[model samples]
Target chain A: MLRLSNLHKRFGQVVALGGLSLHIPAGCIFGLLGPNGAGKTTTISIAVGLLAPDSGEVDLGHGGTPERAEVRRRIGVAPQAIALYDDLTARENLDFFARLYGLSGPQRRERADALLARVGLSDRADHRVKGFSGGMKRRLNLAAALLHDPPIVLLDEPTAGVDPQSRNAILEMARSLRDEGRTVVYTTHYMEEAQRLCDRVAIIDRGRVLAEGTVEQLVGTLGGSSVVTIQTDEGDTRIETADPVGELGRRLAAPGVRGVRVERPDLEAVFLHLTGRSLRD
Target chain B: MNAVLAIAIKDIRLLLRDRMGFFFSFFFPLLIAVFFGVVFRGGGGGGGAGSGIPVAVVDLDNTAESAAFAAKLIAASELEVTTGLSPTEAEEAVRIGRLRGSIVLLPGFGEARRRPFWGEPMSIELAVDPSRAALASMLEGVVTRHAFEGLSEMFADPAKMRGQVRESMDQMRRDGSLPRAMRPAFEMFFNALDSMLQTVQEDSAGEPGEAADPAQAAARAGGWQPVRVSTRAVSARPSGLPTNSFALTFPQGVIWGMMGCALGFAITLVMERTRGTLLRLRIAPLSRMQILAGKAVGCFMVTASVAATLMVIARVVFQVQPTSVIMLAAAIACSSACFVGIMMLLAAVSRTEAAGNGLGWGVLLLMAMIGGGMVPLEFMPGFIRTLSVVSPIRWSLLALEGGVFRGFSMAQMAAPCGVLLGIGGMSFAVGARLFRPD
Candidate 1:
């Protein structure tokens, strides 16, 4: 579990995190959803003690900040950029990070092997990371984050630029980590991912959380009722209502209806309605 | 500690995988060492037949005094003189740059030497090449030193000095060189010298003017070889050939090898930052100090290992033996520490891999050029040698040279080793203070 209270970070004239506060609870996939440049990476960075905030406190649920080495040991970070030594083999890379976490000798080797197999990279364990495909590198990067099996894992856009297969594997790994009762802090600009994977989601923009709730709860809060559009010879009639089934039945029984469409509310609609701009922008 | 060791080991493994780094750090220096070793071995052994400064000591005077002066030129461990060459031949040699210069002992040189008491000016012509402006002065100093030594040797022989004084006095009595008013003083001085010479030369008492043992005197004078000087610098400045050419060149090899390691490691630090591994490292359960210490230790280990490998190759393949193993170890440790500190400073200043590799190596190359790693300090210009004191390479080379062949004792070795450690400490402190952990 990680608790960041009133975090304020500035990069010269640019404000990276504007009085941001986030509390990622234990044993759940807690998603920090935002558009690009929404302080997601900065929040993760501060949470892992990689960058100190200008002002505010980061509590790792251990009565101390991640600035302390022992507190950092309880958390794992998968940075947005693929952080790996290109010259080292996958096994060597894992073994190295494993050793940093205090694994040694046979234990180091075994952990590295297990992680390699877990990421579906056991066949290429001896191959240098330099020769790996982008998707393969993404998988290896995730494995490296899980090398030490820490209590909490912070994954910063783990599936960015990965192939579909690697994306599936990474998503599955995140699910497995959650199933093992490990707290997962996932940061990304992808709205659908948060809707599908996260138990609780917070939409952040300009370094401040706009909304925090379950996906259905967020959509219900601001997404409004589903829009029922009925196209007839006269024209199309649009209606916003909670009872879509009864409305659709009445529309079907009515005079000539050329076409019909039910636009259900989702996170995209919730983001657009809340931010007045598309999430991709 | 475990994390630190892991980082250090990882860096070393990466370096080994880089072909260019591996070659420059190991095989390139080895090539330089082996090539220079073979060349110096053939010529630098204690003034072997043709060692030292190559020049022609043409005796135009052809007298016993001039010949003895020429022999002194050959006796000096600094010059390698060719006696039989005519003035024309020597001049041509200088014109073509085959020799450094030529010194002609003209006609009146012997007469001037025989009657030095009369203030007779010696005739000499030192035809130094135009390109070598300092050559004239350097040769003159060497030749004049030998001439002054001859004068001193004449004085040491009371009888010979007395003979010269009497001849000068007779000439002065017949000629108007001495004024009439000063005639008595000059005669009195000459007569007093003759009397002292007679008493001292005839005295059997072994005090004051006792006869020197011929064998001991010859040994002290370094055995008059009339045409060449031997390598005495091999035994730390006092006659003999360098027994191993590798001894003369391996120190230079270590210097270049250290440069490669320093620049390579510096670039690696920058690369890690640029590639974002530094972020991962910082996020890991390791402090900034531990991370930096790991880097410094890695560079130090690699630098020291390269030096040790070069020395081992020198001993095994080139038949070179260290003067003292303990002193050699001390030199390597201090020098490696200094370069590791330098690597830290370079890494702190470099924001990218290109800057670390290009700018850092450029700085090191300049240091090597000024510090006698690129060329012998003796042959370097005066300004360069003066600037060399600031370059760590100068101290590294000096320490290594002392260990390899300079035969420096522990007490003698303290200065260079101390300076090396001092540089290492200062650079590391400054680098660590300036390093950015982002």
Candidate 2:
């Protein structure tokens, strides 16, 4: 379990975290969703003790600020960048990180082997990181972080440059961690990843929490009775402040519209309606 | 303890695997050591023989005596004489450093034997080039002694002049065989002969008044009588053919290699910082100090191992054995610490690994050049040698050479070690202050 209250951070004149708050219960896959330049990374960084917030407090488990060592002992971090020695073998890399977590000798070897197997990289464990593909490196990076089997895992866009197969495998690993009663905090700009993986989601932008809820709950909060999407040859795609579904449905019926379906807002529609911008933007 | 060992092991492994780093840190020094060792080992007063020395011959008179004197000079081993070289050529050679000196034989130099002591006698002159000042004095003494010997031999040839001396002596003895009036004439002649014998004796004894009193003679010989330098080194300065330029340069090479290790790992630190590896590590609950300590310990271990290996090789292969085991260990430790500290400082300020590496190696090379690693300090000016005192290479060399050369007492060795330790402590403190987690 983790709780962040009224966290605030600033870099020179720019606010990175504007009194943002987050709560994560035990044994759940929690997603912190945002676009580029959002405070998702800053929040994650502060929680992990890499960056200290200008204001507010962080609590772990039973509602108290976690000691640095205690937090380190119980948490595994998969950084956004490749945190591996290119000259070292995948197994050696795993063994090194495992040693940092205080595992030694036989225990380190055993955990390194197991982690290699878990990541589907046992056959290539002895290969140097320099020879690995982007996806393979990403997998090895994840394996290294998980070598110590900590109680909590923080993954920062672990599948960013990975292949779809690798991404799916990583998603499965997150599910397995949750099932094992480990709290997972996943940060990414990919809405699909969050929608598919997170039990609960917090949408953040410009260092502030925009919304926090289940995916369905967030969509319902958009307050739209029905949603309609129309592809037209006309340049103007904007619908004026009238009943969008009514006007769109009338237009479809009058013209050569091929498909029409009334619907509740999807995550993309909800995201646009709430933020006044496209999800990709 | 285990953490330190792990970091150290990892660093050494990495260093060995890096081909460029390995060569710079080890092989380059080995090459330099071999080069300088061969060039500087003593033979005919440093830099070996056939190193091109100049001698000037000045003939004031065209007589046989002077010409014969010049011929003897040309015949002497180790003297290179130029017959056509004018006084200007001789002066220019000494001036521009082409010639070491010129020999001038004054007109009637042979007549100095026939003259009484009054004004300055007609003597051979030795003109020297001051640029090679150290060699000039030595050459002056050598050439002057040779000229005097030749002049003496020219006057002493008895077989060619025996008839003139014997005729005069026979006439004097016959006249002495007369009465009282003739006895007075014979006594005067005998007194004249007595004076000539005394002059010969004085000349043979080399300028009579110049001989020192017994006390003065004893004092003059005392300073250099026992010319032994007390050294603590296990082995003496090796006998036989002297070491070359490579051997002389080897210590510097070792210091340079150690510096390379520091520089290489400093780049690694900068890379970690720029790539957010450091930030991520910090988040994992490791304190900033632990991260820094890990890196420093790793680099130190690599440097120490390299130094120790170099020492072993120097001893077994090159016959270099440092006398004081404790001093050897201490010097290595101090140098390693200094190198680590320097790296930490470079890493702390650099925004990127490339920048750090460039700056670190640039500074290292500059230091090596000035510290007498590339060129001998003997070739450098006094001011340059004075400046080199601050270089880490200077201390490293002194400490290492002291171990093998046995050229220092504890009193002499203390300053070098002290300066090395001082440098290590200062750098370590500065580096520690600058080190930050992020």
Candidate 3:
């Protein structure tokens, strides 16, 4: 479990984090959905102790901060950027990261080989990262984060530039991590990814959490309205109401209304409702 | 298994794969050392302990004094003396680049041995290629120094001095060409010199073996002639120094090698930060200090490795030997530490790969120029040498030279090593303070 309390951070004229706080639960995929420049990276940086907040605390259970080596060993982070040595082979990269976590020589070799196979990269294990394709690199990046097999895994845009197959593989890996009772804090721009993969989703905007709940709870509570469309000879009529079935029934009584269709809101609707439909970038 | 060493090993592996980094860190430095070694070692032939500057001595004057002077030249550890060469042969050796230079002791060299006030000015023909003006000048000084050393020996032997003085007086008295009007002033000076010689001769009269008979020494003293020797060039071989080119150039090469290591590793550090590797490293179970120490240790190990490799190669290929292996190791350790600190500072200051590459080389090249890496300390101008005290490269080179050839005792070794350690400690301290993992 990880807790960030009243984290306030600044970068000169920009406020990256403003009294932001979050409590990620154990043994589940927790999705942090935020637009660009919405304090996502800053929060991750603080959680990993790479950047210290001006005034706040990042508590990684057991009465210790992530700044402590013992506490930090329990956490793992795969950055949004493909963090790997270009000149080093995939296996070498894994071996190096594994060793940094104090894995012995034999253990590191075994773990690196196993992770390379798990990521579907055993065939190209000895190939340098410089020649790797974007999808392969993304997979290798995920493998690196899993090398030490820490309890808490934070994946930031893990499948950002990967193909569909690689994306599915990464999503499956995240699911497996959750199944193993490991907390997964995942950040991504894909709404469907959060809706389908995450047990609890937090939609953040402007460095603050706008909404946080399960997919059904958020969609139902923050859905606002459902649309009832009636197709007629002239055109199609659209209506927004809490009870789409009754609205569609009344609209269908009209002679010009040939057929009626009722639509229910989904997670995307709830996301758009909470954080306005505007491009952050 | 330590995290720091793991990161250090990873960094070394990454640097080794980079072509530019590999060239600078190893090959380029070796090229520099070998290039300068061969160039400065021009015309030195093989012989005489294989350690001194090679030269041929044509001893034309067969007198005891000339023989004594020739013996002195051979005794010099600096000049690898070769005997039994004609003046023409010695001259040809220098012309063909088979020898550094030659010293031709002409016919009048025995008479030219300077006695009290009057004797030929010890003229000898020195043969060397004119283009090698620095070596020419160095040879000239060497000859002058040894000539004086021989003169001191001549002065110390009372029998030789008394014999030469008595012979000069007799020669003066027998010259009928001298005008009778000026004979008394000349005779009075000669008488005074003779009186002084007699008194000195009497003082050592009781020491049996210490004194040589004046007649035997004076008989061997060759006939006097005017102050001149007939030859195209003038030379006198010098004494008491070693001339192994590797001894000098290898240390300089190691300096360049260390710079390469610093720049190479510095750029690697910047690359790690920019490429997001630092992010992963930061999130690992390691402190920021651990990461930096990892980089410093990597650079230090690589720098020391480069130095040791070059020295070993010099020992193997060039037959150059260090005066003290322990001292050389100390030099390697101190210089490596110094540059590792420089690497840290370079990494900390450079935010991007481009900046790291450009700025790292820029700083090192500039340091090399001012620190006597581009030129030796002996050849550097006064101001540059004065300013070089601040350059870590200068101290590193000094420490290495002390170990390799200067035969520096521990007390002599302490200054450069101390400065290097101090510089290393301070640089690492400040660099760590300024370093940002991301």
Predicted model with the maximum TM-score: 1
lDDT (tens digit, per residue) of candidate 1 on B122-218 = 5667775432334445666676667666445554355666789889888989987667899998889889878876665554233333246532322
DockQ of each: 0.68, 0.31, 0.69
Where in model 2 is the C-alpha error above 4 Å?
Answer: A63-67, A223-264, B39-247, B407-411
TM-score of each: 0.77, 0.72, 0.75
Candidate 1 achieves a global lDDT of: 0.81
Clash list (residue pairs), candidate 3: B78-B241, B125-B235, B126-B234, B126-B235
Q: What ranking of all candidate models by TM-score puts the best one first? A: 1, 3, 2
Which predicted model would earn the best DockQ? 3
lDDT ranking of the models = 1, 3, 2
> How accurate is chain B of model 1, given as a TM-score from 0 to 1?
0.62
Candidates ranked by DockQ, best first? 3, 1, 2
Model 3 interface Cα RMSD in Å: 0.8
Model 1 residue runs over 4 Å out of place are A231-237, A253-260, B45-141, B144-234, B237-242
Please tell me which predicted candidate would have the highest lDDT against the true structure. 1
Q: Please provide, for model 3 over B1-438, each residue's C-alpha lDDT reduced to its tens digit, 9 standing for 90 to 100.
A: 398999889988888888888998899989988987887674331121222555788888888877887888888766767788887877655643345678777776776674523444566767764434456656656666777652454544555666787788788889999999888988888788777756655665655664476433322232221223323432211122344666678888999899989888888888888888988888888877888889988898899999999999988998767777888899999999999889888988999989988888888888889887886543454567668889998888878876776555677678899999999889888888998776
Cα misplacement distance, residue B414 of candidate 1 (Å): 1.8
How do the residues A7-26 of candidate 2 rate in per-residue lDDT, one tens digit apiece? 99999999999999988888
Give the Å error, residue B89, model 1. 40
Worst 10 residues of 2 chain B by lDDT: B224-233
